[model samples]
Target: MTGNESRVAIVTGGSRGIGRAVAERLAADGQSVVIVYAGNEAEAGKAVAAIEAAGGNAAAVRADVADETAVRAAFDLAEQRYGGVDVVVNAAGVMPLAPIAELDLDELDRVHRTNIRGTFVVDQQAARRIRPGGAIINFSTSVTRLNLPTYAAYAASKAAVEAISPILAKELRGRDITVNAVAPGPTATALFLDGKDEATVERMSKMNPMERLGRPEDIAEVVSSLAGPARWINGQTIYVNGGAA
Candidate 1:
């Protein structure tokens, strides 16, 4: 593909929320997109339909990000159909909040399995198969810095993501690929809003100087820059938190 024209992207968790927004934005920027969702075929269909309705090319694939085989298949599909993938956004994550003392061991394992292992699995495939000049954007949370209560397990998992992303960037030195993490704070998505009371949501909104929660489109803008022309920005965890941390 010349420039953004006809380039391709693979966006995990693209069926909804930030992933969906990123997929739509990349497609709008002229890249074909593969929306890799865990389940929720209906949501995946909606994302693809929205992209196609906007005159962009997109498809949906159901795969567990933590599953190496499934992730590889997702990559294979992107390569086989679009020639190659130019961007891989590892946005599939699960957050079950609880204080460290009360957190279930099983839940901690589940969180790590999806957030940490999933990031590694998707990043591995991206490192292996993505075309040069590609970008790998992983998701993290500002809680690692905010040190919020009831976020120990989730924060710990994302901290691992932050640690590894930069190392991967260095390891891919000769290749023209960028590895980075987007750590958003208090974004307004089902992932973040679910189970949160109105008062709790308001409290988070006021924590940021912006006095408002981030939109999915807000995060998408950053990803768009990284995936396309922001090659100088590598091995960094950008805190897209409106100065919350």
Candidate 2:
């Protein structure tokens, strides 16, 4: 895309992992990027600095995606800094796993608040503020389909995201916008690897047909395509799960 034709993108949870990768890819693709992190100021700063070093315009903003005021402020900052937002990637999520019998309700609430409610806050802002022909990309996980033993709560939350995506797409029909979700399989991220032993991680990696866990950049590639000139793709959940589900 030409520099003038490039749009501005806001990537939530963008300090690290999949979010970071998506932010970098968007910046590289010529879209001015705003990277939103919850608490990691250092990591956020590093992301912004890297983008600048690579000749891409970027800024880091701190916000809890689950907070309406924070989410709105993030959008406002993007608008003030870059005129308007054309793309939003909702990559902020939490994935604590436990069997249903042992699941902690408090932890469940936290996950739901961030993954489901957080998605709504960001998506609502994008719906209201995004330019015509802009795109809204939400994150889901292949675990929703895999139905792993300990993923009950997490899957339920993501299932809610999947449920809302098509409706939002239809809601934005007249405005020439697209709303979609990307469901990734086993990916190598702190969130995915945390608490898992090497054997567990290796087993998860082998679950994919590709015989390896996904890289953040792999998911970023999908986000890049959806945010670009491919306006024809709308109201769909595209799986970037390496055929895992």
Candidate 3:
């Protein structure tokens, strides 16, 4: 990629929450963005519209991140639309909270299917397609370090993400592409706020020195850096938790 070239990006789970924020940030930074959603066409359209309204190039593709064929089509669209893909952010994930003893097998499978297999499928495509000087950013979670109760299934899936990212970075040795994971702590997204009561949210908020849940934009800032100028920061999992962990 040349200095004058505009980077192109594919962001999985780009319809809402942190993923949406990342997509917008990348677009704002002059990258052509393809917002990939599992089923939410409305949300995906909104994200694309928002980016376009801001004078950035964007499109939305509906695809299951765990489905290889669908993900490949998404990549093919990005390449066809924006010349070539320069970055991919695997922010697609599922979090089903349950204690180890009570966790249902079906729920475990659902969480792993999305969080583990989904990440792998997307990262696999990224490894095969992203151009040199590009990046693959996967999402992990601070729960892996917090050991929070009732997060066993969710935490385990993210632990796999943290493990695989560095190995993938090394595997792409001469490709000049960077691979890394961003682990966010208690962020204020629908995914994080859905089941918890006000009291639980309050407790988690204070756990961080910042005394509040992280904003999607805060995490996006780090992702923006990794996707662009932070070329040397490879094969690592960055904890964006305001020192919570």
Better of 1 and 2 by TM-score: 1
Cα displacement (angstroms), candidate 1, residue 28, comes to 0.6
lDDT string for model 3 (29-59, tens) is 9999999999999999999999999999999
lDDT rank order:
3, 1, 2
Question: If candidate 1 were superposed on the true structure by all CA atoms, what would the RMSD be?
Answer: 1.0
Question: Would you list the C-alpha lDDT of every candidate in the order shown?
Answer: 0.94, 0.92, 0.95
TM-score of each: 0.98, 0.97, 0.98
Q: How well is each residue in 1-245 modelled by candidate 1, as lDDT tens digits?
A: 56545889999999999999999999999999999999999999999999999999998999999999999999889988888998999889999999888999999999999999999999999988888889999999999999999999999999999999999999999999999999999999999999999999999999999999999999999999999989999999999999999
RMSD of model 3 against the true structure: 0.8
Give model 1's TM-score versus the native structure.
0.98
Q: Rank the candidates by TM-score, best first.
A: 3, 1, 2
Candidate 2: tens digits of C-alpha lDDT, residues 185-234: 99999999999999999999999788999999999999999998778888
